[model samples]
Target: MKSDMAQEEDEPSGAVLDQPQEISFRRALLDRISPLISSTYTLRPFPSKWQVIRHKLEQLRSYLAAAGDSPSDSQLMELLQSVTYTAAEAQALASRCADESYTGGKLLLRSNLDVVSAKLDFHLKRLEEFYAAGILTLARAIVVSRPPAGASREDMRFYVKDLVSRVKIGDSQLRLRALGALNEALLEDEKYARILSMEVANGVASLVTLLESESRDVQEEAARAVDSVARFDSHKAALVTAGAVAPLIRLLEKPGTSMEAKERAARALKKLTENSDNAWSVSAHGGVPTLLSICSEESGTSELVHAACGVLRSLSGVEEIKRYMVEKGAVVVFVKLAGAREEAAQVQGIELLLRVACDDEQSTAVREGVLRALVRVLDTGSPKAKEMALRAIENLCAASPSVAMLDHLVVSGFLDRALLLLRGGEVCVQEAVLKAVSRLGGMSEVVKKAMGDSGFIPELVRLLEVRSLQVREMAAETLAGMISVHKNRKRFVKEEENLNRLLRLLNPEEKSATKKFLVAALVILTDSTSVRRRIAASGYINHLEKLAETDVTDAKKVIKKLSSANRFRSLLTGIWNS
Candidate 1:
C-alpha cells in the first residue's frame, strides 16, 4: 500500500494516474513505435526505384530523415502508422507518389495514418530483396534517357554526389554494373552526357579514380569506360581538357593494364587526336616518350607495341606530331618490333611503320631504321607480320623512304617465310599469307624467280584443298592476282602438278568455296590451251549450277567477281556441259 501511494504521488502535478489496464495498452503501443526509428536502416543505399514505387520509397526516406530519429519509439510508431497505407499499399504505390488520396474506411483514426504506414513498410514483399538490383538495372536504363518525372538533371547531380559518397564498388560485377550504367547514361542522356563529356566528364573522372582499384575487373571496366568515352566526340575534348592523358599514360605503367586495355587505349588516342589540339596536348605532356617506350617492348605480346605504334602513327599524321614522333626516335622502336616474336607485335609494328613512313606523299624523307624494320618483318616475321609487312613494303617500294626495302624483301629469303606460313600454320595465317603473296606478286621479282626455282606451282594448287572457306578463297584469289600481273609468277604456278591440284578443288567432295576458287583458278589458267582443255575435261559444271542456288553460302567473294573475270563464263560453260 505504501509503494502504491508513492507511485500515485509520483504522477504529474494535478494529473490523476490512469488505471493499469489503460497504462499497459499505452506501454504496448510505445513498444510497437520503438521499431519505427529502427526501420530507417532499410532505407540506405537507396533501393532501385520502379516506375511508381520510387516515390513511395522517396516519401518514406524523406519522412524518416526529416524526423532525424530523435522521437520516442511510441511516437515514431505513431508517425509511421499515420501514413494511412499498408506497406503493400505504400510499396505498390505507383510512380505517382505525389497523389495522397485513399479510398478506404478501414483506415486508422484520421490522425494515426502515418504511424501505421511506417510500421507496415517493414513487412514488404519477398520481391523487395531484389529491389536494389532491379533499381540498379532500371537506373542504368533510365539514365541513358531521363524519365519524364520527378528526377531532374539537377536531382541526378545531387543523387550522383550522394551515391559517390556512399557506394564503394567491391567486385567485378558491381564494377561492370556501374560501368554499364554510366555508359548507357553517357549514350542516351544529353545532360549526363554533357556532365561527362563537357561539364566535368563525371563518369570518366570516376572511372579514372577507380583505375587504382585492386580488382582487375574494376581496372578493366575503368579502361573500357575510358575507351568508350573516347568514342564520343564531345567527351574526347573533355577527357583531354580534364587532363586525362597523364592518368591514362600512368595506367599503362601499371602491370595490371591488360593487352585489351592497351589496344583500346591506343584506339582512344586515335579518337582523342581527331582534334588537333588534343594531339598537341599529348605530345606536350610527354606522351611521345611513353609511346616510344611501349613500342620498344620486343619480348612480350606485340599487340601492345603495335597499339602504341598505331597511336604514334595516328598522332604523327599531323606535321607537328610527325616532328614529335621523329624527334622521339620512334623509327628505331618500329624496326625493333619487326623482329619480335608475337604475331600481333609484328603486324601492328609494321602497320605503324606504314602510317609514319611518309612514303605515300613525296614531302618527307624515309627513316631507314623504319624501312629496315619493315623489310625485316617481311623477311623474318610471322605470317601476320609478313602480311602487314607486305602492305608496308608495297608502300615503301612506291616511294623515297627505302625503295630498296622492297628489293631486299623479294630477293632475300622473305618469300620462304610466307611459304612456311602456308605450309604449317593455322588457316587464318595461311589466308593472310596468301593475300600477302597476292599483294606483293608484282613486287617480288625474285619471288617469281623462286616460284620457278622452288617448284611452287604444285604447292599453291594443293592449298585449294584447305578446309577453311577463307583459306581456299584466298588461295584462289592469290593465284588470280599473281597470274594477272606477273607472267613469270603465273607460268611457274599453273604447270602440270598445279593444274591437277586446282582441278580437284572443283571435285564433288569439296566445299562450294572450293568450287568458287576453282572457277577463279580456272579462269586465271585458261590462257594456256592445254590447261583450258584439261579443266573442260574435269566434270564440275553440274556442281557449279547447284552451288549457285544456295542462300546461306559464304562464297560472296567469288560470286561477285565471276561476272567480271573474262574466262569465268567459259569455265562455267565447261562445268555445265560436263
Candidate 2:
C-alpha cells in the first residue's frame, strides 16, 4: 500500500497524495492546533489564514526542537509560504532569526531537530552574508560619492570642515587627495561652494598655503580648488585676504611651472578680479606685469593665453591698470592674440585691446597692426567680438590724439563694414556702428561723403523709432553728423518717415543730449524749403520754441534757424490761419 501511494504521488494530477503521508499528516495535525496557538496569545486579530499559518509555523518549530534535527529547505519554504506576513510580522520574524538560541522545543515532528537547526543556520548565514555584502558596497559608494542633491546647509558645512581639515594636515600625498576631493565637492553645487566660502574658518587661507607647496601635484590641485571656490563673489575677498595674489602671480611667473598650474592660477585670478576692489588688489601685487608676460610669452599654452587675456581684460577696466598694461607693451601682445587661432584667445584679446584703447594716452601706443586686428575682428569675429571691436574703433576714432588711426580706419573699408553692421546687426551692434560712423563722419568730409553714399541716412532714420533710447540717440547724432554735407541733408529731407520720427522726439521725455542731436539734425534738414514746410505743418516749431526756454543751447539755436527761414514762417502762418 505504501509503494502504491508513493507511485500515486509521482503522478501529475495526484494532488491528494502530492506529499509523503507523514508530512501531510503532520501538516493536518498543525492545522488542527492553529486556533489553540492563536488563543494562547493576546493581540489584535490577524487574517484567519495568517493566524493559522503563524500557529502552524510555531508548532512546526516546537516539533523540530523536540526532535533535535533540521527540516529540508523545501519543507521550510513550503510552510512559510502558507500566508503572507505584514511588515510588522516580518520585523518580528527578522528579530527572532537574529537570536542564536531559537531552537524548537516540546512539539512532535516527522523530521529530526538537528537537521532543522543546520538548515536554518545555512539559510541565516546566507542572509547575513548578503546583508553584510550590501552594507560594505554601500559604504564604498558613499566614500567616493558627491554630496546628495539639495544637501542641507549643516551637511555642507560638515563636509567643508572635514575636507578643509584633511587639506590642512597629513602627508603631501594625502593632502593632495583631500584637495582633489574638496574640489570635486565644491564643483558639485554652487550652494556647497557658498558654504565652503562662508562657513569654514581659515578655509581659503589653508588652500592658499598649499599654492606654495613644492609638490607640483599639490599646487595644481590647490589652484583648482581655489578656482572653484573663487567663483562666488563673496569668497574672492577671503582669497585675497589669504595672500593668494602673490603666490598666484609667482605661479604665472615661475618658468618651471606646468602649463596646467599656470592656466588654473590665471583663471583664479580672473575670478578674483570680478570685484572691482579685488582688481586693484591684483594690480597692486604686480599682477599686471605677470599677466602681460603670460600674454607675450611665445611658448605659452592656448589656455594660458586665453586666461591671461581674460584677467588683463578685467584689469584694463581700471584706469591705473590700463596705464600699467600700456606701459608694459600689453597692446602689442593683445593685438597678436586677437588674431590667434583659438577663438577664446581671440575674443578675450580683442576685449582687452578695446579697454586699453579707450585711454587717450594709449592711442599713440596702438599701431597699424592693432588697427588691422580690429578690422579683422569686426569683419569675421563673433557678434560680441564685433561689438567690442567696433567700440575700440570708435574710441580710437573719437580720441583727439588718434587722428592717424582714424585715417587708417576710413581708408581700409572700415566705414563700409560699419554701415553693413548697422543695417543688419543686433541693437547693440547697431549702437556701436552708429558711434563709429559718428566718429568717422567727423574725421573728414571725404569719409562723411563715403558714409552718406553707403545708404546710411535711411538706416539712421529707421533707428530713430527703435525701442532702445541709446540707439535712437546715437542714430540722431550720426545723422546730425552726416547732414552737415548737402547730399545727406537732401537724403534726410526726402524721408517723410524720418521727419515724423524726429517730430516725435520733441516730446518732453526725450533726454537733453538726444533732443540736442535731433534739433541739430532737423536744423540741417530744414535747409530744404519743402522739409521746412513739413516741419512747420507738424507743429514741431512750437515744440522747439517751448524747448528753447530750457537750458538746451541747441534748442535755442534750432528755434533761431526755424524762425529765420521764410518758408517755415509762411507754412506756420498758413497752418495758424487754417
> Which candidate has the highest TM-score of all?
2
Query: Which residues of candidate 2, in runs, are more than 4 Å off?
Result: 1-165, 187-203, 254-260, 275-286, 296-306, 317-320, 341-344, 363-372, 399-409, 420-431, 439-450, 453-477, 490-578
Clashes of 1: 28
Give residue 266's error in model 1 in angstroms.
8.3
**The candidate that achieves the highest lDDT relative to the unseen native structure:** 2
How well does model 1 score by local distance difference test?
A: 0.53
| Model 2 TM | 0.54
- Per-residue lDDT tens digits for candidate 2, residues 307-375, read 787788778878887888888888788887776766677777877776777565654536555677899
TM-score for each of the candidates: 0.48, 0.54
Q: Residue 161: error of model 2 in Å? A: 5.1
Q: Candidate 1: TM-score?
A: 0.48
- lDDT on C-alpha atoms for all candidate structures: 0.53, 0.67
Instruction: Give per-residue CA lDDT, model 1, range 1-578, as digits (tens).
Output: 56853454455543423434323433443343234323432542222323123333433332222121111322223223443234434333321222333334224322233543434455222113223333112122112223444566545543333232112322345446656555555455556655555433144566667766676666666666677778778667667755677767766766777766666666667678767777777777677887888777644345556556666766776776776676677666766666777777666667767666753542333545565566566556766676677666556555542435555655655567667667776666566667666656555554555554544455566676656767767777666545544554356444566666655555555446556556654554555555545544556443434455553242332333433443776788899999
